[model samples]
Target: GGPRPLPGQEVSVKVLGALEDGGLGERDPRLIFVPGHGDVVQALELGVPTMQPGEVSFFLAAFPYAYGRPGREPDVPPEAPLLFEVTLLEVRDGPDPQSLPPAVRLRLGSQRRERGNFHFARGDFAAALRSYRLSLRALDGPATAPPGPEEEEELREQRVKCLNNCAAAELKLGRAEEALAACEAALRISPDNGRALLRRGQLLAEQGRDAEAALVLRRALELDPASKVIHTELSRLAKRQSPPS
Candidate 1:
């Protein structure tokens, strides 16, 4: 047998959750996560580490350890506890964000980003933001091995994408200041990121920082001269800046 699933390692498992009445709660035939990385519920994170590969186990996770007070809504009731059945399928060592090579980190980050996109498309902005932030965490950590140039570029591009998504989700959640910070962070990573530029400009204009918004929007326009969305935003900004009659 290989090493037991440990903190900072990636584990693949099948998991099912049920109410005490034998009613189904939640189930995933293929669930993958890294323990101690907030990838799964606290119970799984704490319990899976003690399991050997190919083992099936059950654990009772109180509300705090499972879905917490709000309890995942609709499926899991508020403050309701769940019984979890978990199968520890495989565990890989040192998929740790801090210790993974750039390539591995990129792949993990991409997976999380895709999950964020899935949630966003479903109008679950909070869930989408959580996944996007996780993707950023996976992408931002220091690499264990030195990265080649192409890998570095790939990593940077992914980071910019996640940050832009974070900004969009933040705005959707009405956290404009957080959204602005996310946009700035993306622009710092890649100054030519048009999505970041457009979002930042919109945030600035909304906050009445007209000159700053104008500058940012102009740069975004330079980057994507044919973007109808950018042009619309620019026109709206112009109307706001015009002296009220």
Candidate 2:
């Protein structure tokens, strides 16, 4: 009850109320933990720094600080205000990825990769690239001997996937050279990776290196013969190379 919780500190609290439906009828006893750096809903974020442990208070958050224009449907209405009856329970230092256990770090890396894929599916290539880079960063650690065989293999596979994803995102962003570099990195990890080979081939074709693209595409086809997209690209390249008819 002395030093107030800071912005970059993790805090646990009990929140009693909903932003919509006027508010909860019962005091919600369930505890909620806010992460460091306040990467949370704006209401809790703005209110947390003002709380002292064990102190209970109610705060009304305006729509701008709550759900905004497009609110969370079926719960919070558009431009709805939020009322929170909060009781701060505990405070602690937030997570530091470098200080986490290896298993946790690996999971975080995988989570980042999944987030990248989500962004990529939404056609947000810049966000996808950021997430892919973060995934690799999560896997980065002190340079040392290889890990145990199981973890080593897992890491190798994860890095290869991350690099391949980065290549795809870069290609979408029209960064052919960067895409090629990422594909090269992925291929270094798994030379026969069909996706990486396909990406590299596409980048080569885009750069007008038709011969190199054909060679790479052939290798990719050897790995993934059923890929119609790759087959289409090969046909396009062939037509481009054919003499005037």
Candidate 3:
């Protein structure tokens, strides 16, 4: 057995999980995740970090740590505890987000963003926002060395996408200030990002900052001249600014 894993480090473990009745609940020969990232259940999140590579351990997880009150459908009953027999297979060095290569960041960032999208689609704005924020963290920091033109461009694009999605999720969660910040961050990455511009403009308008909203919306229209949504927003902004008319 090697050294135990630290937070942020990636771990690969083989898992054999059983329900309260000793019936099998889950079995995965190879499961990889970074601790504290919500990739695994809370019990595993707490258990795996204490294990050295090649070590095997058993953990008893309460309902809150496993599936919670609703439990897993058709198998694990509500409030049933679980017993997990896990083998720590490997531990990879955790990458510092700031020092990660652009390509690696892009890959990891894209995965988190996709996860965010899945949560968003399921109407879980809080979870979606969390995933989007994680994606943003992965994409944070510049390349330690020079990246290819394509890689740099791809990284910026992915960052913008995550920031925009973050804005969307934040808005759904009624965090207007946070949503506006996310829009601004996206615009900083890609100044001509239409989605970011539109969202920023809308948020500004909602806050009664008509002049700022108009400027941002005009730029958005220039980027997507045929966007009827932008056109509509522009019209609404004008009406608000048109005193008494």
Segments in model 3 whose C-alpha atoms lie over 4 Å from true places: 1-5, 16-28, 40-85, 91-93
TM-score result, candidate 1: 0.70
Candidate 2 error regions (>4 Å): 1-99, 141-146
lDDT, candidate 3, equals 0.86
Q: Which candidate, 2 or 3, has the higher TM-score?
A: 3
CA displacement after TM-score superposition, residue 183 of candidate 3 (Å): 1.0
> Which candidate would rank higher by lDDT, 2 or 3?
3
Sort by lDDT, best first: what order?
3, 1, 2
Cα error of candidate 1 at position 41, Å:
10
Tens digits of per-residue lDDT for model 3, 1-245: 77889777899999988997779877899998888766566789899999999899999999878766666778878787889999999999866876877777888889889878866775668867888888888877765766798988888898899999999999999999999999999988888888899999999999999999999999999989999999999999888777894
TM-score of 3: 0.75
Query: Which model is ahead, 1 or 2, in terms of TM-score?
Result: 1
- Writing each residue's lDDT as its tens digit, candidate 2 over 1-245 gives 76788655778878765655765522546555444322234567778778888998887877766555665566667777878888888888766666666676678789878867866765668868988887787676643344576876787889899998998899899888998999999998899998899889988998999999999999999888999989988999999999998
Off by over 4 Å in 1: 1-11, 15-31, 35-85, 89-95
Candidate 2: worst-modelled 10 consecutive residues by lDDT? 32-41
Per-model TM values vs. the true structure: 0.70, 0.66, 0.75
